[model samples]
Target: MKILLHNLTRFGDLLQSQPALAELAGQGHRVAVACLENFAGAAALLPEAEVILPLPGSRFLAGLDGDWRQALAAMDGYVRHVKEVFDPDAAVNLTPALAARLLARRLCGEAVRGFSLDAHGFRHESSLWAAFLEASSAARGLSPFNVVDLFRKAAGVGLGPGRFALRRPEAPALEAARLALADRAPEGAAGYVGFQLGASATARQWPPDAFARLGEGLWQGLGVLPVLLGGPGEKALAAAYRETCRAPSADLVGATDLPALAATLCHLKLLVTNDTGTLHLAAGLGLPSLSIFLATAQPFDTGPYREGCLCLEPDMPCHPCPFGLPCPIGHACRRAIGPDTVLGAATTFLAGGGFPAGGYPGARAWLSGFDRAGFMDMTSLSGHGETARAVWLRLSRRVLRQFLDEEPLAPAGQERFALPAAVHDPLAEQLAQSADLLRLLAGHAGLAGRNPAMKDRFLATWERIRGLWTASPQLGAVGRLWQRDAQRAEPDLPSLIARIERYAALVAAFADRLTRR
Candidate 1:
């Protein structure tokens, strides 16, 4: 099979999708990728891709400002060229944007998976995992699966050992990177530690002063020099770091391109960075990283893909904040993680010792690893007891994996489900309601094909069930999966009935498990 993947996203996302692409290639399929022109260079890092198509998104949009007809013509020409060069048997769109959906439809018609548009211009999600991703976008904090896992699942790839890595740059690029580093750093430093100075969003960035303080501590305590890294846009942050700390450091901000950055990361002892593209690049290079997650960033979903990487996030109720929303408390999560905490983690990791076993008052620590099923997993190092939200998130993950992957559920003690009254009571009520609705839908589904009134009643009951689950954050995963199965089973009354009964059994079993616990 010739599979074409459409990922019109940024640098970090492109790097993260490597496992999915590699899986497609490993399965004896020829993989081609279509990405934005600006990050086309990044596509070279994916060794699995046999063909690379760079879409002139920026240039086309730039042309639209002056001449709309010319822009359309150029876009059409590019589309034709893509279709002619690598005619794909299947298309998987990793981007959820409208333009990407339309392009995927044009490229492979009904064979497109993930998100795409129908012939009537109606949006469609072709897989259960895709629907789950769509639902996760709305309830961010509740999602327990890593995005890399979701991408592979959406692309119809099975979960396996996540050992995929980026292709290293050429020998010349590596040598140039080494020479650049040698010229910048002082002669007698023990080794280099990277400080990634910027992130894609301000909310996700750690304070520059904190980084400077950490740098100074690492130099004074561990005999390592701090090598600052960022794109040209982060020069201001670089200046701020220089002004804040009196430590000896080398600033390579805006000095190197993507390939050079990867080559340079190979020499680092460790990378201490905000949640950014550089973090992903360093992970791709197999460089150990200690990444800070704040505001809308969390380690569970978008942490570095490599196992044994360290991740830190502020321990706040409002953490992993919703996207595009202003912080109600003035981004206090920024102050939650102090420089001392990070320096300790950095030193501990460097010494070949794991994270300190002590509790972090305002922050949490996690070590990245793969679970038994080879999905990216995080083990908390903070000694604090699990919160109610964490319990629900864990349960949600188990339930979804059981339904989607046929994984077996482990037996747990009643204490595991001992959520607070405030959380448990309402959730129990909602699950009961959902179970009842599923039963009603399943009972009526068999009669729907023969009787018009029965069909109307069955449809109404189904919508009610949808509304009930959609409104509850805890049950939204089940709703999303059920929605996908129901959509796929439509026009077949027996199949739809089977789906409804299966979901009913799932809810009933879950409710029984909770009750027994």
Candidate 2:
């Protein structure tokens, strides 16, 4: 079968979709991609695509410098090319914009996966991936999967620890990049750590001073040089940082193109960056990375899609925000995950150690991904699904404390979650404890519900566990064996997680009965 893919987003997002491209190619289907001209140069690097159509994006046409009719005609010509030159059996759009949704309808494909306009002019998305993206911006904290996996899923492709194949540059690019690095290095300096200073959003960029301090310390303690990396947009900030930096460092912010940048990455011991395209670029090159996710970005959805990389996200209440508007708290996410916090994570990674055994208790641990080949390895650092809700309980204490401490209700009342502990009555005490547990479970649900995949799994697993637990008492002779098997080292995580959820639900039901007593 022939497949056409459309990704009219920016460069970084285009790169993240490469694994899905690989997945498409791996399925023995002929593949072609239609992308914006701005990313055409980068798209030229996809090895799996037999065709790369650098069509004008809807954004460009909407912002045309001349006649709208002519622009429309030009787009029509591109659409004609799709129908005539590279007719596809199906088309998948990874972008979620309304304009892109309309564009998908014009492509030559029998089936379309993302947004599409109906005959009456209403936009619709029928796939789970589409629903995830629609909910993503607002329910930002809910996803347990990364953007890469989400994109693959949207395309109706299988996901696993799939290899993300990017076009490799010629060896000359690597040679040139090494020379540039060597020339920039101070005499007797050790290898460098890349400092990607800027991000797509103003909220995501870390302060220049913080980087300077981190660079100086790395130089003093580890003999590592700081090599700043970013596009031309970061040139001014790079200049300011170089001027103020106490340690002499190399600034390559606007010096290299994509190929050369990949070559440059090959020389670095590690790259510390804001959640940016460069981080994904490094991932493709197999370079170790440490990404700092500030503001609304969370590692769960967009962390570097590789192993041996560390991410640091603040445990701020308003964090993992949607970032739809100006921050009301001066970007407390950034302020909370400060230079000191970043330095510690950097130190741990460079020291050749993994994240702490169970991850940092709260705000100060190495934030991690499951390292699944394409987009994720696990949903949370909650240790292979032992109990993500337990992590939620620990993380949300401050937010849920108010409700958790509500006074228990009297022997007969309407309160289901307000059972106060009684000094004399054991039944009242049990009811009160159940209420507190219910509050904690509700808080965990708040985070677990963000990712649609996890939410689906949680519910499905909840029902399955309920069935098993309910049947356990009926297994007259083998009940103890079933319980013992569940307690082994290789316990069933989904079943365990489901029981935890069931426990919370049961507590609420129990509390409801006590209040009416």
**What's the lDDT for candidate 2?**
0.65
lDDT of 1 at 153: 85
Q: If scored against the real structure, what TM-score would every candidate get?
A: 0.91, 0.71
Best by lDDT: 1
**Which lDDT tens digits does candidate 1 get at residues 268-340?**
8999999888888888878889999998888888889988888888988777777678888988888899999
RMSD to truth, every model: 2.8, 13.5
- Of candidate 1, the 10-residue stretch with the lowest lDDT total is 406-415
lDDT of 2 by residue, 1-517 (tens): 8888889888888888788889888889898888888788777777888888887766456747777777777778888888687888878888778777777877743377866665565655545345545545444554445677677777877456656667877788879988998898888887889999999887888778879888988888777899999889899879878777889898898988877788888898889998998898888777888787888777766887776677766666566665467888888666666666667667766776554434433352344444423346433442423233223222222221212222232232442322223311454454455445445544444546565555655454434433443332111111222232233232454544454554454344433443211
- Determine the backbone clash count of candidate 1: 0
Model 2: CA > 4 A from native: 58-66, 83-85, 353-517
